[model samples]
Target: MDIVVFFVASGCAIASAIAVVAQKNPFVSALALLANLASLAALMLLLEAQFVAAAQIIVYAGAVMVMFLFVIAYVGPRGEIGGGVRKPWLVALSVFAALLIAVEVIVVVFGASLGAVASVDTDYGSPAAIGKALVTDYLLAFEVVSVILFMAAVAGVVFGTGGRPVRLSTEQVLAKEGESAVARRREASRAALDAARDSTTGESAR
Candidate 1:
């Protein structure tokens, strides 16, 4: 039963991931990514990592996927050929590296068991233990992650907003306005000088 569940979850994850890459529409790709996250969360559950599974669902499937969807929607609908194959070699290299890493992880963790390994107690997804580790040993890292998340939120707001001049200091705004006025005056002066030169040339010719 565990094997069946694992295979099913793995297949779902792979299928959804492929769909994410294969879909032409940005919205459809985002939805496929959401499906992939949900499938991965279910895979974590099957491994008895309840806390990790919940985190996957809450943090990734819920929050991150929603953000991705929001970005797609805010960016407006793209044409079919929005993103082109500009860097095929780079993409190929990245895919190769990812596959190499996946193979290395499989060999290191489950080479003996033919990729099947039983979950241990120490590896159990206990929320209390996770909390203790996060707050005690990894407190700085946790705080850094929180800061990164905050920055991401701020960036989203900044990028998604329409173009507008942000509020500046009074002195800065005044300086900019004065500079514009000066530029206009200079342009008018140049135009008047050119007209005067043309008129003088015509009178001399006459």
Candidate 2:
């Protein structure tokens, strides 16, 4: 059963990851990534790491993927197929390096005697234990992440409002005023010409 679960989870993860890269549409790619993340969470659950699996689903597959979708919706759909692929060599090198790392991880896992590893106690799931660890070990890092999230939210609001500039430089202000004055003068000249033409037509008729 364990072997079957592992194989099924692994296949799902790999298939979804491939779909994410292969899909041309950004929304499809995002959905594929979400599937990959969910499959990963399942794999973690199979490994008996329930806490980590829940965190993965909630934080990454839920929140982060939703955020990505929101951004995609805000940006609207792509109109053009992107330019030709560039730097194929760099991409190949990256894939090669990732394969090498995967090989190393597999070798280390299988080569090491599984019996030598200490058994993990499942007591780490307690709320008190988690709170203590977060407060004692990761408090500063957690606070920093919160601060960053707050800053990002504030920046999104400020930049997303889509308004005209509140402050203009002297040259910009002068240029705008000059353009307005020129437009007004042109309108006045056009009005005067129309009035003169009308008067001339009336005199000729008389």
Candidate 3:
């Protein structure tokens, strides 16, 4: 049963990871990443790391993915790129990546014996022990992560608005609305001119 579940999770994870890269749009890539994270959580469950699995789902699949989706929503969809398979830079990058992969595979094939290096304690992967380690030993790292997240949020707000000022007052908001109204009026005038020209042409023909 565990084997089956592991295989399923692994397959899903692999497929979703591929989808994350193969997707051209940021929103679709984020969805793929969410699926990959969920499958990884399932894999952690199969490994009997219940706490890790729970954290993976709650922290990564839930919180992190929510952030990803928020950013994607704010950015909107990516514009389409026009280029044939003849993109030189992409071809070069692919060849370089393939060569790197081949070298890594060669090294792994000729690597030392894969033996158990050390025995893990019974409760090594338990939630309680990990929590203790995080608070005691890894407190600095935890705080650093928090600070980084705060900075990212600040940066997102700055960049997401494209440096536009937030129109909090009614006058400013109305001015922006007026600009849009002017654009709409211009479009309407152009459309009306085209319709009148067509009518005049038809009348003359008749």
Error of 3 at 154 (Å): 2.4
Error of 1 at 160 (Å): 3.4
Give the Cα-based TM-score of candidate 3 against the true structure: 0.66
Which residue window of length 10 is worst by lDDT in model 3?
77-86
Q: What lDDT does each candidate get? A: 0.84, 0.83, 0.83
Regions of model 3 farther than 4 Å from truth: 78-86, 102-106, 117-122, 165-206
Number of clashing pairs, model 2? 0
Q: lDDT of model 3 at residue 11? A: 97
Rank list by lDDT:
1, 2, 3
- Looking at model 3, residue 178 earns an lDDT score of 70
Candidate number of the best TM-score: 2
lDDT of 3 by residue, 39-117 (tens): 9988887666788988988988788889878867765644325213657898899989998998999899779577865
Q: Enumerate residue pairs that collide in model 1.
A: none
Global Cα RMSD, each model: 10.9, 9.5, 6.4
lDDT of 1 by residue, 149-195 (tens): 89988997897676977876656755878767766867999999999
Going through the candidates in the order shown, the clash numbers are 0, 0, 0
